[model samples]
Target chain A: MTKTLAIDCMGGDYGPSVIIPAAISALQQHSDLKIYLVGPQQELQQHLKQSPDFGNRLHIQDACEVIGMSEKPSTALRRKPNSSMRKSLELVRDGHADACVSSGNTGALMALATVLLGTLPGIERPAITAELPNRKGTVTNMLDLGANIDASAEQLTSFAIMGHVFSQLADDVEHPRVALLNIGEEAVKGRDSIKLASDILSNQSQIDYVGYIEANQIYDGNVDVIVCDGFTGNNVLKACEGITRFLYDQLKTEFTSNWWSKAVSAMVWPILRRFQRRINPDQYNGASLLGLREIVIKSHGSADSKATLFAINKAITEIERQVPQAIQDQVAQLLLNTDNEDEE
Target chain B: MTKTLAIDCMGGDYGPSVIIPAAISALQQHSDLKIYLVGPQQELQQHLKQSPDFGNRLHIQDACEVIGMSEKPSTALRRKPNSSMRKSLELVRDGHADACVSSGNTGALMALATVLLGTLPGIERPAITAELPNRKGTVTNMLDLGANIDASAEQLTSFAIMGHVFSQLADDVEHPRVALLNIGEEAVKGRDSIKLASDILSNQSQIDYVGYIEANQIYDGNVDVIVCDGFTGNNVLKACEGITRFLYDQLKTEFTSNWWSKAVSAMVWPILRRFQRRINPDQYNGASLLGLREIVIKSHGSADSKATLFAINKAITEIERQVPQAIQDQVAQLLLNTDNEDEE
Candidate 1:
């Protein structure tokens, strides 16, 4: 089946400078891929003039309004009737695109996706899932990284189901081990919400629900899916980003200090590059808003061409693997089970 | 006034290898300082043999028990009657030592200190405060970084007061601006507990409460004192540590890759060392458990001699500044007002 992706061309810091080239590269690499670029037609067309196949495979949807990064998410959505993010979601809603990719305001994208594309039948909230690189060359899928801050127990259960299906479909993990993030490892430890969620998850047979996992165990590759409320997950993700930036700055200062150290630095250059490639944020770009009827990948706003390409690739993989369908199937099973329990 | 610090000799990873030398270094540097070393007599005495005036400045208490790093904190006090951590707290309780310092399990130390020295007259759980390095040369004081996992409104109010006093004593801020860590800057953005705590903090006359501060503002240097529940605080701190470690590993790999980069690295060695010193975890080694009657500093379990010495210096400073006394005065005033209001 041919896969078509709706791109928010005007989103992100570098805008078309990064996204345009990336879309072209993605289209060139993936022969089955067709991109419907959504943004200001004039600017997008001007940028597309440089590409050879701009008219052949690329389609444009005029969306003049843009959501500024600093704009209030709710107010922007209400005020800007023809924003690119909204139009992209509309394309997915109308079956013109299999997936939507944007590096725009995350809150705005989430709101637009929920309103336009709508969530899966039994899903309460759409969770954003990011794949983090583990030591064993496998990625650990973490969910609700910031889609919903205040989540109910039922929402958390939905996140686990969506996270499991995403991992299985996109990452190809069969019966993925799903673990809830808690302060402590023991099943008894954590707040009432976490404890109650654990009990609920343990009883659900559809998911391979493992016991509680501590924050420290996140990098150990012990579980395939780690789930938490948006507040905790966002904090953890930001903290990880902040620390990485801090350490990189510190190391840059260290290596450039003296002559002898610099000489030694040259000898180990290639190995270092290999390691950097392994952990680069660009390699892990594109967090998907799982549980939505259509696949929507949120790329980093500051991403360059490489990172944008990674996000586009992620969108392709989601469409090819039928991630949204898998999530819908799981949610249907959960709803049926809930109904059965109520009857009993 | 003489300042005496109770040192838990058998607490840390390397124990005496680091603690003994650090204590000696601190003593030599601060002439007014006196140390009450609590551990087994034989090992401490043998280690003290290297210092000629050890007997004159150092007093040894034969506790004969040590708390293991991995042991459950709740069981440590009752299981081992003469555990070094318990004995250290007792010294402070009996007024034999003005302050106590340990590099053992933090949970155990907090439990023992709460049970032994007790909280300030009307205070709830004592808070753990640590000074984190911000973007500027100055530091920001953060509290409840992992003392009580679940904090009530009253406990949060106490934390705010204690955190203010801690910054005044350590960071030397006369009227520190205290802020609650919340999901957003708005008062209505967080959980009910956070909203109640924010209300209480804003109304308090003693503390210079500056309203809600979001996680993004944490490194912005706007607020001098930040307070949150232990679970959230712990997650933030650990996430920071994890990210720092991740970046360090990534950068080291990046800088050591090639000859030209190594040459540049050699020239920048001194500058890099200065940067390392600025963000060194060792420089900010000690954490104070506030709201306790006696001052207690918790050092990292894997701390080296330099980190241990930093902890000792922190203990001596707290003792000299009479941190406990300041907290007592603040709590007393708060209690008086509360009692009067209740009576009315």
Candidate 2:
């Protein structure tokens, strides 16, 4: 199926140079895929000089302004209307693109996307959901990763429903088991909001609500979907990233410490590389801003060309799967069923 | 100075068997330490059979009831008055012991400790603070790890103050740099309560407030103390644990995949083991329940004798340092200073 994506060219660390190539590479990978490279025209054109032509499948959309990584969301929304991030979202909103992929300022991207593309029905706010590589070699989808810091019980329930649909579609996990992220596995554990959300999910007929799971059990892969408020989810994700890097650095230090260790490290380097590739954060670069009216994939700001390609491909996949549409249907059905249960 | 510790022998996974041996080891390590072994008389005696007696140093306090791992905190408080967990705390409450060490149910332990010993002056609730091994080979003390689910701005400021005092006393770091855990380092990022806490912390002349820090910077060791609400802190801590195990397991699987890999792994096993010990959760086992009237160390529920000894030693360190008195003094002074500032 033919799908179009608006690439935020003036986003991330490398900006146009990294994103333009990734978009071009993505276009090559998917023959039916089209991308609107949104950025400052002259700079983007200069960076795109090395890229091979792909006819009308690739085109440039001028966005004079660029959002700084540390730019406040409200400031970005008010001041930077012509930002690459905003332009990318505008493409999706105006039906020029099926989805938007940005490795830009997350706050700016979220704010601009929410303002431009709006949200799906019954979802008060969109959630940022991402796949974390787990023990089972499959991905565990966790949601509300810094979108809404203090999600109410209803919002948490929405996240669970959206996460369930996402896992089913994105990972092709049938009957994806959903669990609430808490300090303890017991029902009595966690804050009142979490407990209320648990109660709401327990009575949920749509999702495979498997009760509360601790953060330690996240990578165990016993459950497919892990739901938490944005604050907890964001902290957990970043902490995992932090520890992964710390351990890897420690391993590298150990391998290079002495002559004997260095020699053995050379022999085991291939095996280690293979293992590293499996757990590489680049593979999981794209985080979907779920429950949005149109799809928006937020790539890591430091993502290289390869990682940006992954994010672009994520947009393609979402477009193909119609993730937003699936979420809308699922949420509507779930809410209707819930209303019926409440009435009964 | 002889310091007395009340050990909840019926706590944790291994219970009396693990706790008794660990207590024995702790006694051997600390010559000036006295222990009150709180548990069932017959079981405690059986576990102590192989241990060489220290005359009048180790006394068994008979508490027949044991708090179940899954027992509700309120239920445990109400029904299990004779529980070993409660008895250990009671020893502290009655001034029989300077500190209490439990590897039992955390919720019950916190509830019982809070109810029996009460909070320190100018403190509403106690926080669970533990040291995480950071990249700099030193530890970062993070607080409110699942003790208080929803901390108010005032409560968070109190946590920062408590954590500051703890780092000074326990970690022996002068002018410890403190930071509020947030999704972003920006002043506008995170929830309102976090922002309010930041505002409160910035004006405080008592401690070195280093502004906001993301969770990914947690292991950088740039910040001495990281303070957050219990929910976020707990999730981050657990997620770090989860990822560490996940990476190690992946490494193990890779190293044991083939004969060549296995042979290489054999040569590198010693190095790997050394690296593992550095990041082992067992080494950082004891989490201090700070802001309480007395010292209480909650060890991991699954901690073996080695880890349990770490917890016991932690209690001894707290007793020697007089952590509670220090926190009480610090909190009182900080409150008085804040009141003076308000008047000004």
Off by over 4 Å in 2: none
Model 2 chain B: worst 10 consecutive residues (lDDT sum): B335-344
Error of 1 at B146 (Å): 1.2
**Model 2, position A262: C-alpha lDDT score:** 91
Q: What does candidate 1 score in Cα RMSD to the true structure?
A: 5.0
Model 2 per-residue lDDT at B8: 94
* Residue-by-residue lDDT tens digits, candidate 2, A8-56: 8877888877888788889888899888999888988898788888999
Give lDDT tens digits, candidate 1, residues A216-247: 56766779999988877876776566555545
Report how closely model 1 matches the true complex, as a DockQ value: 0.26
True contacts kept of 2: 0.88
Summed backbone clashes in each candidate are 18, 0
Lowest summed lDDT window (length 10), candidate 1 chain A: A245-254
lDDT of 2 at B292: 90
Model 1: residue B272 alpha-carbon error in angstroms: 7.2
DockQ of each: 0.26, 0.83
